[model samples]
Target: MSSTNRRDFLRASAAAALSAAVPADLFAQSETAQSSPGAIWDSGSVRHLLPTVSDSRMLIKVSFTAPVEGEPRLHVGDLTVRGSMGDTRGEHWHFYATDLGPGRRYPLSLVGSNGRALCQPWELATFPGPDERPNRFRLLIYTCGGGHEVHKFLPTAVRNRLLRRGLSFQPDAMIANGDHVYWDLLAPVGSRLLGAAPEAVKAAGTFDRSAIVLGSDNETVLKRAAGPQIVPVYGTDFRSTPVFFLQDDHDYFDNDEATDEVVTFPPSYFMLQLARATQGIYYPEFLPDSARPLGLPWSSGRDRAWGVSESFGTLRFGRLAEILLYDVRRTQTMAGPSAVYIDPAVEKWLKARTAATEVAHVVHVPSNPPGWTAGKWGEWYPDVLGREGKLTTNEPKPYWQPGWLKQHDRLIEAMAAVKGRAPLVISGDLHAIAIGRMLRSGRLDLKDNPVNVVLSGPLGSRPGPLGWPSGRRGTGAMPSAHLDMEEQVKPIEQHGFTVADFTREKIVLRLFKWDIKTQPVEAIDTLQPFHTAELTRPA
Candidate 1:
């Protein structure tokens, strides 16, 4: 054979041998992997791994130890779906896959540029389709889950152990009602009192508008501020469970306080920017629901296109129940009589959902609670802490808006009007585990159809001394003067969560709690719920 023909034949033979040695799928994956430096993977490199799944879709948020060099890929079943960088910084990436089968558990894994698995494979199941009715559904609910770096009020070990105990129940899903990040820039405990390391403590001083968040020098400070609060506490514990994270006042880096100098809520432009950046990196946004209509206020282009929402969300578990989740802090306004904690459009959507009969049960999960108040400025009632340290409406709260109370009345009335199923509201923000039935609000009387409210306790906060670090409200959560409530389980200050079991007949709520000083460390492993409240369908 000629020299040229011999070289061609050798090249073809080498190519054929290489293809035979590699698996067909891996070879195909390598072809699509980005032609750039990529993220290095070890079992510990992924600092945070969380996924949120809908009936036919799943969105996974993966945060690496360092900025990723190229796009990551998710391998599920027979598909190799490409992922996009999810944050301004390169550390966080997202993998969104659609066309998944409803109610089916699919094993998923991440692959690098070399076509090798980055970590062990895990299984995630999609929710049952809207029309399909599963026998039972269970949800794990909690709030104020963020902890400071300096204080051991809620040590990392205790927080993880408590969550592990709750996970032992094998809940179908989890809802972190609000206040997921507690780095309150204005609070003394968050500012000067935290026990963080010297250098680390220095970085938490003040917000720097000079540097862009997640993509600039602020990235280091942001990580130092939020990383320990979230990463170590959750780790990979929630890798398999779908988590619905709702943001509140603290998530925006401020407390819901109104002082002569400033009103911390109605988040400022910078606070909003930081909140968005934090969420984009640490967790997944709410999956889109077709029932939630279009043209909702502040609907970003990406949010509208993907049908995902940043503030409003829905947890539709077959036809057994439909839970509407809304963040009260994000879009709150201060237009006096025109003021609203939620947009008028969102309020309309909420009322419509409350009145719907297709679902056996309808529940409202708001970032703010209604039945009780801690005498805070941002509340449904204009109650303030009396000189004696108790919530009293004798003196109107300073800077409190009247519209908030009006909107609260409208929502309660809507829930009361529902037929067949009992009206229920499960809320977070108040650091207590309590259940009450609101028979009246302002002039509106929900006498015949009382609104059931549940404060699904705090997971990471402690009721300790130095109330600021402990996150214990000054007056605790108490029934406001205008509210006529039947307090089933009065507000109890402790670190805990609620487990709710939903069926067509009724809903059962179990409250589990533990005190850092009282409960032995080992006792956490076998901790059982302390209170149980059952609400049945209307006769």
Candidate 2:
């Protein structure tokens, strides 16, 4: 079947499942509540939430203030607050009042346990109506961050400053390509090595001092660790503003494995659960059931794992472009002939979507093949490199290995076949920023194959001084022994997120590196003007 058909089938299936999950009465209640002016809410302990999208019918996922110990009750009628989605479960509520309507300010009054009403500082204004014209959207991209140490936030601050300047130039959306959170590293020390040990040795090691300390106090360590707090803060700052999130190796499990295989690392699951719980992701609703198989097929061994596969489908914003959200992590291969490969179904879907679109822009969310050669930063097991010297055996794996230019060539072919359109590939993963144009071989019949590939990463993590593995460096800001791109493209060393502004006539990709010293540290480097690109329609 074609990709579009498959996607339609999947959506239909999910909608059916969702309909089944919510009974008639609950659905009617939600519908009624939505029609009425929602109650206003105050922001207190509610930190952050996830899957930020603007579809009115979309099932919103959120997280709010956890209840105090032994006092799990909150009386909503007492406090004065603003900008709330609404109350669902008793005492527990999710707010989505941002940008609701003109002149109508919605705020909620909350009654605390003390019988006093406190007002929340923030209010949710209704969102602006969709733009009728082709609207320009910017995406802030980053990936492969190891942890959220204070230093990590430094780069993000710098990038934010740059974005502030960039935003002045153009409006845009933020896309966190993957590795949004580095939860795997927060696992207690020595936990990653658990499976490598023999059963007897593992049992004995489990009782060791370090293991006992970590296992006993894993939650405490994770809460205090660099990632938990940092991710929420970073997410809160950006997610509320504008963004789309994709999961990478770090978000799912360290080095990219199914959830079941990495069960020994309790903190990984804990952090993910916390992220979901706090964000109001409605895990049971959005995620697929482990007991059943649907959407993308998985190995029998990989079934029954705690993971969710979601296809954002396609977004056509007026006449500007079509944005396709592809989940590459779910279909990854750990022990197969290759390390990374797009599922055949997904590949077909992508091809059909691109082929069907004549819109001025197309955005894909996956790390470009060329960026993988930067070497693993103490993340995944090193033994997985196949005999082909490539990470994966997928058709695109061989020519696309490391520093080879053929990866770009194959990518160009794929784009050219997409109804002969020139596509701008937006990606993250390598903890660095890159921008380049890929020109297809004349043999491919693509006159405009030289489309740009824009990448930004390390939003919270710091950029390393040099490329990895010394001799096999691919492409990065650092001068390396492996690949040299001085003639073709030069990488700049600014550690922050990236924002891409797309219009009908052109696509401008701007890199925003944050400046940490400023009080509201999310300032941009004034020196770097917007990096603009004017793309002509393909003939």
Candidate 3:
């Protein structure tokens, strides 16, 4: 109880406090992380995916701030699947548990290397196998996001209404067809600039916009945003459903403005590297063998100033449907009809799948609709020329430029070759909700086939479709061969998702829409789709 004893106690307390402090390091390695364990990745980085395949399998992955010092295994039901943190994204650890049994639901949690419960478990749902014919299933497609921290960057009520819809019509699986999150800013808030529209920041893929939501150089920031800001929007459904995400221009660069030159792409060198590393941290690709596979993202040789990835591939589901996921941003032609949107490999794969006699349908998931949407930025439409390569405009440099039109026809021809199943093109971009039948007879027609093109997008943005009162956002749509016999049904330009119900016989599509400006969450609780249409196999 003497003054000397009190002094000794104070010294010990001070030493412990110093050792336990967590340093505010962004991406720093540390021996004294107990006080402030530098993040290898942020807490709770769980991502779910249903690998493209006819069979059932689910993939669950988590990114850790640092590699687990010991072992990391995921426990689902009575089965234990070992996970490895050997993968790194700028010192951050990526742990994956893939190819787990499909068709059953299970609660998943982490069992640490040291034999302790590392984190809470989540419920996962896998798909059915190839030989299986899933008469029908609903899939939620999300795309064209506002950005990482929607709260900070804009006042828009960023919401994903389809995710919140309960068990009644909740989707069986989900597809994030790119425009997932925006990360164009290179500096902190104080040193950055922004644009009027989210796209404006790229200033239409020409300007440098700055805003700090996460770190271009730090995995922790991106993980934190994905955990709290991004993940939950899918809500409890994410606990049980599978999600597949593909990258677009935004996921790669700020936004891609398809000028006449592929060599002049804005994001090159370190900027591309930052984008690639950040992307690697968030959406690591996991392709199952059962899903028809193809080569992955690759470099355009020197153009890859950012990252190298193979974002195009295919998945065939039994004899029911085939899913074709292509990277429009990277593969897009440097200029015009012959530019080569389908890398010869991708086209070959598409043609082979189309030729397959078994599959009844093809679900084509492209980043943007094959062409432009009259509802939003119609002039930016690329396929202005008709099937015969006849120009519609007489201007020297018209409002829109030429693009992969020839290749576009090739894509549809391949689709027509898809023996039994009518190709269903589901896409994202142009913050409008429009389901249309392509006008093949028009001068601007896509082709002679009945390929139906649908839009599912703006999971985060303005709540209404582009032209609301009429709700015919897509009636007089761009004439792409893909949507030849098209009719605009309930073209309500609003924030929403499209659910396509598929069976061996037909695929009926329903557009589920929402309004944050009015009902907020109340808008999504509906048994009926805002609009619905049916498509049967061609006779």
Candidate 4:
């Protein structure tokens, strides 16, 4: 059968199933009806759920504690769609509905084969159509949400409290920039903080490195290591909100380090598989974009079918704003002169999006932060730690590739070239809250139209012994070499997140901070933005 015919047949079958599964009285209600507040919620079978939405698609991942007895379907008012089982162990289920109405709210529930509700009925709204413009769009943005095993620096309870506070503002969506999990199997400092016995760590390293994560012994080990970091903190609190999760160095089960004995970047095949498995089980893949080709890096033929890119994604809010999301760690290469922190294809796509005027505002959300470097081997700049733990370019940074800097300059130039819009970049990896502009990069000068960057605050970092790895690198984020720039909000090591509001006239950012040492735990409930900056659209 042709593709058109296949789609028609499936649609008819779904309608028939919906007629049979849904009650006659319930089917009378409109698909866009409001969610029932007093609906029965089943927290036993469905432990948790997270959803991702686009202009016309909604993808939800549900976790079950026990095996599902029969086929489960997602009931969205009068419409019912079948759920696809995920993972070999049968705990994860994915319900994907496409060709949904744009900018419409859908109240949905999951019903089992026996016609019992599996989860609470929740509401999710799709994005506006491509040509349409929204008056306002709000996002809850944060980074470094993961924590060390034994470290209580921003424990799960505290993280949830912060997230609930952010939710109170009722953000349209959430962007978890990077470092969602922190169980580094390698790297010296991280390994010691694994909070596991030395023997157990050794066993995990050997077994996980040799096994495929999907069906083999590695899946359980991967779950044991990653589940605690993600499931507990996020839980079902985000059931009504769409989340975009970007992976960084720690998400690959190690830090980006290059020492004499081992180089931890350009993730090994096992590391890549483990990362894939973790995302496959926990989160939703990025929805498809017509502008982004499937041949891009970290994409497979199977991924092409789903139209999802694991490393590159787009969060478009109507014609008002388009935020490009890219993972700078997974596809990075270290081939000397050609080494790149992001795939060249991704760079090309980013440049094209940056230059496009389809959206009133264009923002870049990379897992790797620009503007400041911590004198690390994986950073774009070649700066190294000087005396008194200051960053300086005089000392050569070992294992630092020059190609990374070249690519960074090209991207900066592309963002600056855009007319009538601020070249805004929000990222999180540096573990600090900072706002700056790249006035000059190497020989390229962005002084006329500087590229603005914001280091979205870390959500789970602390100071002293329980702080982020950067706490050991230096005092905080510092200006790297070869760049002339001005720091508006100088880097401050604090635990917080950024709330950004995108509008046609301007983009407003409210940066919130909470110091675990200086502030009381209850202060998190009423934390306010310490600073607010507005970038008005160019005339």
Q: Which candidate achieves the best lDDT against the true structure?
A: 4
**lDDT (tens digit, per residue) of candidate 1 on 448-539:** 88999999988887446544222445666789888899999999887889988888999988888887678786776666778888899988
- The C-alpha stretches of model 4 lying farther than 4 A from their native spots are 1-44, 195-206, 300-305
lDDT of 2 by residue, 24-62 (tens): 132123211321011132233444433333322112233
Candidate 1 TM-score to native: 0.88
Model 1 spans > 4 angstroms off: 1-44, 187-200, 203-206, 298-305, 467-473
lDDT of each: 0.76, 0.39, 0.49, 0.77
Q: State TM-scores per candidate.
A: 0.88, 0.58, 0.70, 0.89
Error of 3 at 512 (Å): 1.3
Candidate 1, after superposition: displacement of residue 308 in Å?
1.4
Q: Taking the tens digit of each residue's C-alpha lDDT, what string does model 3 give over 1-539?
A: 47565434322311111121123231132322221111121123233212222144433445443456665776666677665331343223333444456455556655566665443344554566666676666666756654544324312223543455422344565677776655443322211322233533332323222432234323344453333334434322344445566766555534443234323233455444544544444444434443344244353223221122346644544557667777665555455434565567667766776676766777778776654343222222443343343433332322232445555667666775554566677877555577765545234443545667777745664333322312323233344332345556634455677777677788877776665566455445452466878888877
**lDDT for predicted candidate 3 compared with the true structure:** 0.49
lDDT of 4 by residue, 158-276 (tens): 88777876775557889998888777777766666652546445534334476567788777777667776777677777777788988998888788888888888889887788778
In angstroms, how far off is 101's CA in candidate 3? Answer: 4.6
Clashing pairs in 4: none
